[model samples]
Target: MSDRSPAQHSDMLLFLTDEQLRQGIEAMFFAYQGFTADPDRILAGMAYGRAHHRAVHFINRAPGTTVNNLLGILGVTKQSLNRVLRTLIEDGLVESKVGRVDKRERHLFLTEAGAELERKLSDAQRARMRAAYRDAGPEAVTGFRAVLEAMMDPNMRRKSSALKESST
Candidate 1:
């Protein structure tokens, strides 16, 4: 149990006013912008955007993931994802293969060049996250992650949790 008294807990909850909520929302917006700044700069030179970065990041996280599974994870339309996939494939950043057990399914993996680009993008983001985590301390980082998970939609939360589980 927490050490705080009932009155103290109640008072803390009451402190979350409209203005406080707005400030929190604004903070999240700015934080997201900062989080993507480095990657955005790198992608801009290559004529890509956040969508491309997200696809590469996820494909790297789960190598040999199917296109259908990726569509679910990304929550994007098939046409939109197809466009990105086409570009990545044409650039030799990603390779697509037919599933042995399910010939109809297409499994995606990063090519050597794709892995290098993924490393560059992730390194930038990781450095920012590492610094932020260090500055926030362990407890704040934990709380921040909890807040983010709570903010996700139920389907997205499940997908994210599955990815986390798979990585471990």
Candidate 2:
């Protein structure tokens, strides 16, 4: 019997066939669809796309977050995000105001209606996540989280970890 760390075990199993990789790719595609299914339905009735949903969600999560901060979080180009933000603001869902200390910076917040919509969208996703987590069980849930955290880019992991720490 050989004793190897979990990382070493994963490294040793790195040789995968084309079929295996194809299966993984298919699984990821399906998983993404499943993840988006509920939100897609909700957005369909509202005439808003995933970009609006994402902006509302992050604004709800961190009210008064700066535009630059959101641009960083979403990893989207400034022009792209500006279009979404403009639409959301015009639709009365998001409120963007010049920063008190720094007039050039825009801080974002969700209105009452915006918060309601955000809650509805989040509830749908949470229901899906809850069911998947329950089906996967306690051990798999832990390992799944670990693997996802490990998969994150170094800077992203730092930001994610910081958010987790702050929320707790």
Candidate 3:
């Protein structure tokens, strides 16, 4: 809530020095580490990895999403995602159903155990984000989100927007 207008803020970004950009990059790296720390510990105990956590999260978000759709969202090689999916399927954490319309398509869903794990992961992340948002105040929170959205490429931004729209 300063006296500056949106144009002033945009102009200010134009003058960011190399050191400023470097510092911002480092901050993002450290912030990501902090954000993932809790989930990493949880995954370690379960003999899982971040890839599995990501799959569980996205599947929970859009139950019955197709494997091809997931591959697009995750941008992982089919072989890699298949390995993770295989493990999850074998562990009884995820369920895959053959598509009725297209027999070749496989839809993914989280089982009860997967849902529980997703809850734990989400709760941990939400707690951290809640505390940070509280400390940063509403304006900073909004600005931070805008900055993040701006950083994404157009394709990713569209995908992100679609997911957000679906949630609402």
Candidate 4:
């Protein structure tokens, strides 16, 4: 693939053998496991799992996010998200307020305890990502992000980019 023209690169990608694609898919599976390993360990002790971690992370990112918006972001069923939210709320990690203007809407915010948990989870992930990016190098990091973005659904990509921009 080295020194290939962009057209050639496209052609090569289009013609990737089943074996090549399989290897890439396998790599992604393993990489995801590695990425989640630390957080999984932390969540295990709390009787929570990846779903809870994901909810906390996103809620921390966008305080006062509505339940409906979180449902969209997480792509989980209303019932399932409700279960997680109920647990978090009961544990005092999340506070859900009735929307002032919309009585049916529940806007979520992390309590101090929730923020602390989010910090720990994020710190672990950031350390892992930072080391991996350093090992992969700047160019690989750029290419890696491009590949990830390209793999996302267009709608999800837009949502993700908007969050990134807002965060910065």
- lDDT of all predictions: 0.89, 0.85, 0.89, 0.88
- Backbone clashes in model 3, listed as residue pairs: none
Give the runs in model 3 whose Cα sits over 4 Å from its true position.
1-13, 164-168
For model 4, residues 23-119, the per-residue Cα lDDT tens digits are 9999999999999999999898987889999999999998888888888888999999999999999999999998887777778999999999999
Off by over 4 Å in 4: 1-15, 163-168
Candidate 3 to truth, TM: 0.89
TM-score to native of every candidate shown: 0.88, 0.84, 0.89, 0.87
Residues forming the 10-long window of minimal summed lDDT in candidate 1: 159-168
lDDT by residue for model 3 over 19-133, one digit each (tens)? 9999999999999999999899889988799999999999999888888888888999999999999999999999999888788888889999999999999999899999999
In each prediction, how many residue pairs overlap at the backbone (N, C-alpha, C within less than 3 A)? 0, 0, 0, 0
lDDT score for residue 9 of model 1: 47
**Each model's Cα RMSD:** 4.3, 3.9, 4.6, 4.6
